[model samples]
Target chain A: MSETTILRTEQLKKSYEKGKYILNNFTFSIQKGEVVVIVGPSGCGKSTFLRCLNLLEPIDSGSIYLEEQLISAKDKNASKIREKIGMVFQSYDLFPHKTILDNLLLAPVKVQKRNKKEVEQEAEELNKKKIELDLEFRKEEFLSKTTIWWPETKGCNR
Target chain B: MRDMGISVLFQGNNFVRLLIGLLASLRIAAIAMALSVVFGVLVGMMMRSKHGWIRFLCRCYLEVVRIMPQLVLLFLVYFGAAKHLGIDMSGEVAAILVFTFWGAAEMGDLVRSSLISIPKHQYDSGYALGLTKWQVTVHIIIPQTVKRLLPSGVNLLTRMIKTTSLVVLIGVVEVVKVGKQIIDASRYTVPTSALWVYGAIFLLYFIICYPFSKLATSLERHRKEESV
Candidate 1:
């Protein structure tokens, strides 16, 4: 229960029926910048645990806190809590109608209310990085060219 | 001489009647398809709702539409509902209403399945991004649903074009009705013309439907190759 805790869950539980529990007495906490993974067997509820963390699934009983803000399982504001924790899927899940740049910029513009200019700058930087990575993958000699595009645009660096 | 003969046939009174009838049916089918797609997506989303009552209501709608034949449903709306409600409906209007009802139910099922086909991880990933439910739905869930649903919707559109012929039974003049008219007028003098007329009808349908089939398949293939 330190002041710097980014997420905390207490006694989180979920059950399909009254006497059976898929998750019972689950509790965990993670500080900001912490990288955590929950691994288990096929039906072991790792995904379910992630769903609970994101409040995508309703917990039968529990409380979750993000940055000192409490998230109710049934709260109308659950959506706001969802925006802070970006989760990359095993599948890329990129929008087909959108190009790669649009997919990356969608949440930032729509959810975070960031300006389109700022978002596009970030997108271009990411694209340049991707190109650099591709070049590196093909041959290591182009490592020097990685910073060639560096600082080409102000405020592009995340 | 052959071209002159064809132009003369085309300019005949019977040909004009057939042309008008076919256009009317196409108009009705197009409007109905548009309305049905909008209604269907909303209903389909509701069908997959977390709320039990919403899901039940949508399920009941699907069952009712499925159990009743499309022709019967058309008749009920055209004859029964119009009479009971004391509303005046033209044959074309009645056809649109009935087709829309049927289309909505069918489209809703397609949409629901498409929505479901989206990997569960997509939604979780959307949520992980701290997107609100509406944001996730609009930005993530719906876009994914569209990619999955478009192929099936195209298939449904092709079927709808063929189904528009059923409107002829309701006294709506469509391609088939016009073909029947040609056959009726020419049967005594030139019975062989019936086969050609029907063949023409098949060609017209193929022209309308073939592109949609190709589009559906290609889009599905492209989507498969795309990132999830």
Candidate 2:
């Protein structure tokens, strides 16, 4: 893999039980600015593989590298690594209890410890784009705001 | 001032004694309910643990509390412990301990079910934002859980208050015990005083328990409408 490969997993092995390998020797790498989709039949380890990429699932045998840094190590800081890799779900469910602005502000302000005023001001620019996007979108929460907020997060746009 | 047995209820300090006894019952129930919420939330969170031993321990605790009656738990803590372990604990303390054990178990189950009622993706969404486990729990998960859990908690408090009547058997000077004392004292002069005093005790319990149930139902309705 080239140095620009942001996420790489080598010889990945995972199983729910011994000798029943769901993911066996799955070596894959994605380069920067590449949008690659992995499609397969159900229970073909697609979701599990995606989960393992973000450290949500642990690999039984193999290694995961994010920008050539070993993030799959047991002792590495998971939150720090996960901050650099954002995963959106199929449902697009934002925190329903919070307002749209609060949902956008949560990671940047709380996780990154950034200045609220600066973050709010930065987000205001996105709000204009969001308004334009909303004109074509259905009036549903799942699709409306979360799509706009996705770009504000780092590494997600990569 | 008629010599009938009904007058035996409100005569002099007899009324004061009933009020004091009711306060004692409320005190114990309130304390136990508070402790239950604190410990119950902890147990509920722990029930979702991935470790085998922790989940096993939580399951065993819940089953034991379910199979064994709350009164039996009280006796084990109060009389049995005093007899065998020489703990010499007081009735109120024992009642609090037993009630908290039972209440926490019930409340923990309530919390667990309410937690599961939320969609599974919310946790994944929070964690994917690079928020720590505790951050997602405290900031994202628990606020929603508390909003859903409150009505059931208020309902549980009323049940706890009614069950506090059981503590009188352990020799606590609760409302019913004092009512029994009043009836026994007037037994000779007013032979039918047991009916009046016991009736008065029932009225006191009704007055305390009814409003709580009304509030719970109203809150429950609001919760249902909002959840949609």
Considering just chain B, what TM-score does every model have? Answer: 0.87, 0.94
DockQ of candidate 2, scored on C-alphas against the true complex (2 decimals): 0.72
Per-residue lDDT of candidate 2, residues B1-228 (tens digit): 458888898788998999999999999999999999999998887887788899789889999999998889999999998999999999999999998999898898888888888887788878888899899988898989988888899999999999999998899999999999998898888889999998998999999999999988988898788769
lDDT of 1 at B124: 64
> Once superposed on the true structure, which residue ranges of model 1 sit more than 4 Å away at CA?
A1-6, A9-51, A72-76, A88-99, A123-158, B1-8, B11-16, B52-57, B82-86, B185-193, B225-228
Q: Give lDDT: candidate 1, residue A57.
A: 78
**Which segments of model 2 are wrong by more than 4 Å?**
A1-3, A17-22, A134-141, A152-158, B1-5
Candidate 2 vs. true structure, TM-score: 0.88
Question: lDDT of each prediction vs. the true structure?
Answer: 0.73, 0.86
- The prediction achieving the highest TM-score against the true structure is 2
Across residues B118-154, which tens digit of lDDT does each residue of candidate 1 receive?
7776776566656766887888888778888888888
Question: What docking tier does model 1 reach?
Answer: acceptable
TM-score of each: 0.76, 0.88
Tell me candidate 2's TM-score on chain B: 0.94
Q: In terms of lDDT, which candidate is strongest?
A: 2
